[model samples]
Target: MRELLTALLSQDPTIEVVGSATDPYQARQMIKQLLPDVITLDIEMPRMDGLSFLEKIMTLRPMPVVMVSSLTQQGAEATLNALELGAVDFFPKPKLDMKRGIEKRADELIHKIKTAAQAKVKTLEREQDTPLALNPLSNIKFSTTEKIIAIGASTGGVEALRVVIKNLPANSPAVLVTQHMPEKFTKTFAERLNKISAVSISEAKHGERVLPGHVYIAPGGKHLKLHRSGANYLCQLTDEEAVSGHKPSVDVLFRSTSEAAGKNAIGVILTGMGKDGAAGMLELREVGAKTFGQDEASCVVYGMPKAAYDIGAVEHQVSLNKITEAMLNACGAAKDRHIRV
Candidate 1:
């Protein structure tokens, strides 16, 4: 597997293949010597587990790390944990036909590695066992069920979305999220978020009625869109062709929100590595919906938000910590609470 990965990565002229290690101990020594821009760590290792080594790396060195994980339930959970622990991104390891699968996804692996190299790595702080306290906005009673929050993210989205969602109040407006993830991973991601967040979160199902206090994540291989069914909103899932090189493209979600919810929707473009949501955000803004972008300083990779901001699609630029409050304030759900940009 290491040989295949090394050979594949070496094919890319832009990516330099550094020394490969047989275990985390060897990898540690190599890292100290080579000081590579990015490290791709496998989730499972012989001596020290990838997650444990990842924690140590984030704590001591704090360099961007991309996890190579298996496409399984355990892998999904572990990959999400790595993301929470400050890993930049994750790539699913091939399960069957290793050589063929790896070769087929060679481009994707290279892209992830390159993106990780540019990510703004951060130290991993110890997480509390308890869920975060509900945002102060929870005290305010939202008046209407008409508002919808549409969020688009990729690359660093797992952690970014967690930070934004965990702070939202239980009574917050319905949230529709389009995050780039694989099939099984989205379900695990939603379940993990549900455990920590005040709001109910699940992978969106086709035709499910979108409700307040709930978050609908776009199913891994499907696109999630908001549609008006009579007077109430419904979650619409489609297996349409990939838009913006992503199935659950943020562009598809935001464009649908623009058409279906218009001024009643709030669009947020978070950290990512592409321009998927920029045009859709512009569409939302043109229709009078409030739009927000995660500022570069707070983003691990400021690609999507930067693209949106550059095109004037974002009405307000906000940090990751304040995104939830800003969205709630825009929805007019937080009475008397003003978001200080």
Candidate 2:
């Protein structure tokens, strides 16, 4: 194990394997002695389970952590819990054949580690500064017409989506999301999102009726389209080829919503990598939809929104803190909350 880890470090000039251990006791001692930039943990380590050790480490000395997990039910659950507990990400495989998994995915693991090492990890306890107003819409009168809100994101989207969706009123029009993530993670993510928000959120189902006051999440590994059904718009999820290098591409969602929902749809492109949603956002703009992008200052990485802005797809640029209110304004609420004049 140490040999493989050493090889991985040597291959990457930027990474230095400070220290590693075969058990949680040794791991703790190594951490105390080395204080490495990042830790790649094996979930099945001896002495103490990786998840429990991770919980302890995060509670005692919060730092960037990435877990190596198997593609089994237990591994997935553990990884999800670790993520919720402040671990940045997990690399998964179905086998314990270390040579094949480690060598074949060394580059990917290297990238993940580099990103994790630079991440600003905030423990759950440190995030309680501003409580989200549980009923922010108590005093505002919303419009009667049905509306649909379309949101696009990638990279650091999970946490961002939570902040925006949990604040949306139960009466807010149908919301659709296109976030760049793998197939497995999206289901878990949707389930997690549903638990925190007042509005109902679910993974998008093919041929499902998209109703007002419900949020439809685009399933990962597929494209989601919106079609008009008499005065209503319904969702259609498909296993189509990847568009813009992503199956559930933001451009695909934005374009479909533009053709079907037109002026009734609101398009928002949040923090992400690459230029996936730029052209589609322009299409939405041509069809008279309000479009927004998270400003560079608040973005973990500013690639996606920057591309959209460069192509004139985004009409307004706001920080992560202001997006939920902006969506409400796009829905014809009193414009004083999420948007600035």
Candidate 3:
């Protein structure tokens, strides 16, 4: 697997694989000597595991690290944990015909590596206490007739969304999310969010009703849109060609929501790379939908939100910790309940 990755990365003109080691001792020696800018690590190893090593690296010599792991249940959980422990990003190691899968996903692999190289790695600290069950409110009111939330993220979105979604109250607006992720990882990512968040979360399905307190994530390789059906909105999934270099693009979702939900929608462009959602966010803003962007101080990449902010697409640029409350306020939720940033 390491050799395959090395060969793939070596083909990219902008990337060079500095060194490879089969064990932790050799890896430590190479890190001290070569002092590479980025590291691609596998979760499973013969000696010290990737998670343990990642914790050590963050504490001692914090730098950008992308995890390469299998697309299994255990792998998903461990990768999520690794993100909490300061890993920049992750890509699933394909299980089927290795050469064919690697070749097929070569562009995505190279893109992630480049994004990871530019990513800012922060020392993360996780709360060890058990999560308390949240009560779903029965009397929350929306300023508009219908309330909908659209979110788009990439790069550091795995951990960023975890913070934003987990902080939301149970009876918030119906959410539509576009996260640049692979097909196999979207389900796992949604499932992980469901376990941690107060509201239910799942991969979006065609014609599914958009209900309050539920979050829908766009499936990989497909575009997810919002369409009004009578008084309620419904999810519409399509196999449209990639927009802004991604299939389930933030631009597509924001534009669809802007057209379908109008001012009733809230468009949020979170931490990510590139300008996928910037133009769409401007459309949403023009149509009177409140829009927010993740502030630069809290962003992992700051590229996407900065682009949107530059075009006046974002109305309020808030920290990741304050975005949930800001969304609630936009939806007419009480202001006194705001969580500190």
lDDT of each: 0.92, 0.80, 0.87
Please report, as a residue range, the 10-residue window in candidate 3 with the lowest summed lDDT. 129-138
TM-score, prediction 1: 0.96
Candidate 1 off by > 4 Å: 127-134, 334-341
Candidate 3, 197-300: lDDT as tens digits: 77899999999999988999999889999999888799999998999998899999999999999998899999999999999999999999999999999998
Model 2 segments beyond 4 Å from truth?
Answer: 1-10, 32-35, 55-62, 95-107, 123-133, 138-140, 334-341
Number of clashes found in candidate 1: 0
Worst 10 residues of 1 by lDDT: 128-137
Question: Each candidate's root-mean-square deviation in Å?
Answer: 3.2, 4.6, 4.1
Q: Any runs in candidate 3 off by more than 4 Å, and if so which?
A: 128-145, 334-341
Collision count for each candidate, in order: 0, 1, 0
Q: Model 3's lDDT to the true fold? A: 0.87
> Can you write out model 2's per-residue Cα lDDT over 1-341, one digit (the tens) per residue?
65776787679888888886988899888999999988888788777998889888888898888888776656666776777676766677546776877788787678778767756665555454233354565345567556788999875666667767877776778899998866676777788777766678998998888886678888868888888889877898888899988889999999999999898888988876679989999999888899999988876557788999999999999998899888778788744357678
Each prediction's TM-score versus the true structure: 0.96, 0.81, 0.91
